[model samples]
Target: AADRVYLLAHGKVEKVGEGPYGAETVLEVLADGAYFGDQALVDGDATWSYTARAATACTVLVLTRQDVLNLAERAGSLRGHLDALASIPEQRTNKYGEAAIELSAGHVGEAVVPHTFVDYELSPREYELSVAQTVLKVHSRVADLY
Candidate 1:
């Protein structure tokens, strides 16, 4: 799926996710001028964990990953803001965005705890889809014969 950032320009949107027993839970209700998918700008391959549904008739401003990056390149403040948002996941959480816990189980007394750190993929795989079409010109006689 093509993930793009959405800015709520008008109306309302309900951000929802699957809850226990497969129930639909409302994560948040966004009003006009709210933005979702900021994380998409940072991680191109990241999949959305939640879904956004229209609460009412809405108008949204959409920005693709490339669009946001291009804007960030020309705007120094925006580039800094995006960088700060990108670093948040690495600073306090594991790759899964969960709290990092250090535990040593089944260890003998006086054994030093092994050091570990979260390692991220330097070059993650990115997939892009493209389409090609051919236009064929058939003669009137050829078309009738077929």
Candidate 2:
């Protein structure tokens, strides 16, 4: 999954893969702010189909396909984040003022184009598996496991 999608926090990582007939290729070298696995995540696949290695000492933040699904089912926290995104108003502006203008005319044979309204994209996608990660911010009994 590392190759499929990760956000680099520091240092660097490389994506290596094999082509037809066992030919190896360096697919990409990614640094900070680079991300992949979006295609797989959007398309509903959890299996990582590539190999990832550290080009240097590195740190990364990852979101696996299953974790994305869990975030959807357990989206109470994400709602606030999304709601904040929704409150912003979108408009079209132009030279005079507005980009979209209304027009109406009467004639022997006049063709009218009706306006269709579209809504914002804020729906959750369905997934088959589940995933989660926990960052321990305390020195407690669970520290023993580490």
Candidate 3:
């Protein structure tokens, strides 16, 4: 369900979070063919939660959830977009391009850290803290790049 209503040309579009006489939520200036209302299609939910309109004349393409689902099967088409969009982070290979177990809970009596420790005691607090700290460090380092 990746289909979305989007502005396609030199036209202005608007989206309202609520009905008329309610708040006017203008769709931010989006590039031609860029997505709007993607969340509704992605979630496969019925009824658009927002109202969209083009302030100027422009061609608009409406894609259905079924259309996107079907497209994902074909290469060099919208299907690739769907596959990429729907893919989960875990399904993605690591930087080494490998499937790796990144986390584990000690309740399973397992040390989940990437590095193994000798002569280390597994206190509940320590285990949880270690995982959190590692995650924070990795995220911080990655975030810095952007």
Candidate 4:
């Protein structure tokens, strides 16, 4: 039930979840620069399926859901990046975050193999650079006084 995304800046973190038999299981061990609660970026109502605990003394950076939306509005690149990330289908990735391949093995008869393709982004994330300019004006009388 995390309302914000957490980025582990230093130390280690353990993602724990409950097993079917009411046992606590360690789902993943996250290291520095790892991201947790990232589903909040795409789904506003998303909740953490697992709990994160610090394995060691850790420094975490947190960003609320509204903070991401506000930043996305200001930066087109970030919006596009988030959109691309959200567009990835869950079925395409495995639990280890690797590409999943569908295969049929030891079939009695001929089986139809599932066809899958890797989705690639045609346009990668790009940033828009902004510049500011100012003009200083002075009167002739002011210059004479100086």
Candidate 5:
């Protein structure tokens, strides 16, 4: 079961989904700060519904559901914040079960202004043929395969 969610701290990961005909579906490639395995934590299901393969060398922070619950328990303010966030179904789906979340954020009875943006990055890393330096919490030698 995929009970632990991983926060991508460095590099990239490709989430592979199993199609109805046993084909592999290339789900979105996750970058740094991307969170995965939330469906199990949010929906209370622990079954592994997909597979994750490293697209490149990566570093991740694993957080179990229990870890989250413990954090929420330790902080009363966090519990309230979590409750408010969980109440909003941010991702929407139609009867056909396809992701239909509006690109412009807003929901019925709620007023949300659409956000526009310009190119923004914090010292963005450059990849030449998928090769770049990555940071690790522990100092060690990493494979230079990339």
Candidate 6:
């Protein structure tokens, strides 16, 4: 029944204690699939003294102490799913932003139109092209010119 605990997603450990610091075992390292505060649940204690950080991109399923006990008592499927989730990395949800294109009067005269893959002139050897699609997704903020 502590306030905080930590889990390990990879095989690494970090220790924090009193060498030159205030003087206390502030932290203890754990391995992948290790539990930190099981004694509090078994003995009805209330206090925690450790925190955890992701060693790599990990899928952390956080639950309150009560929820942890409930899930631990549930069917084995929940535990299996937790194990599976622990083995995977967190995915990035990319957020696209609005972009503008600026060209000189003689560059984008009035007769030419640009597509998603339009190539823009540069130097004699370096030219850039657009690879982004023109279609906007649902609720996407799009700004562009013809």
> How high is the CA lDDT of each candidate model?
0.80, 0.63, 0.54, 0.84, 0.72, 0.48
Off by over 4 Å in 1: 90-146
Q: lDDT tens string, model 3, 33-116?
A: 555756544466546655666667666667666665666666566666655655634344555344555564454454546753
* Regions of candidate 5 where Cα sits further than 4 Å from its true position: 20-22, 88-146
Two-way lDDT contest, 3 vs 5, winner: 5
* Models ranked on TM-score: 4, 1, 5, 3, 2, 6
Worst 10-residue lDDT window for candidate 3 reads 125-134
User: What lDDT does model 1 reach?
Assistant: 0.80
Predicted structure 2: lDDT = 0.63
Tens-digit lDDT track of model 4 for 1-146: 56799999999999999865779999889998888998899877887888899999999999998999999999999999999978876666765566887765443665666887876778975748698678856545447788
Residues 26-142, candidate 2: write the lDDT tens digits. Answer: 777888776756554445434565677889998888876577656756887565654554465645654333345444545446457467454446786454768877774633443
- True lDDT of residue 138, candidate 6: 32
Q: Compose the digit string of candidate 6's lDDT tens values, residues 42-71.
A: 334655444444444554434455675577
Worst 10 residues of 1 by lDDT: 103-112
Prediction RMSDs, each to the true structure: 23.6, 22.3, 14.9, 23.2, 15.7, 20.1
What shift in Å separates residue 132 of candidate 2 from its native position after superposition?
44
Q: Tens-digit lDDT track for model 5 on 38-83?
A: 7545545668756899999999999897788788899998778767
Best by TM-score: 4
lDDT of 6 at 47: 56
| Error of model 5, residue 88, in angstroms | 4.5
lDDT of 1 by residue, 1-146 (tens): 44688999999999899765689898789998888987788877878888899999999999999988999999999999888877775556664455675755443454455676766768985647697678877545448888
User: In candidate 3, residue 111 scores what lDDT?
Assistant: 56
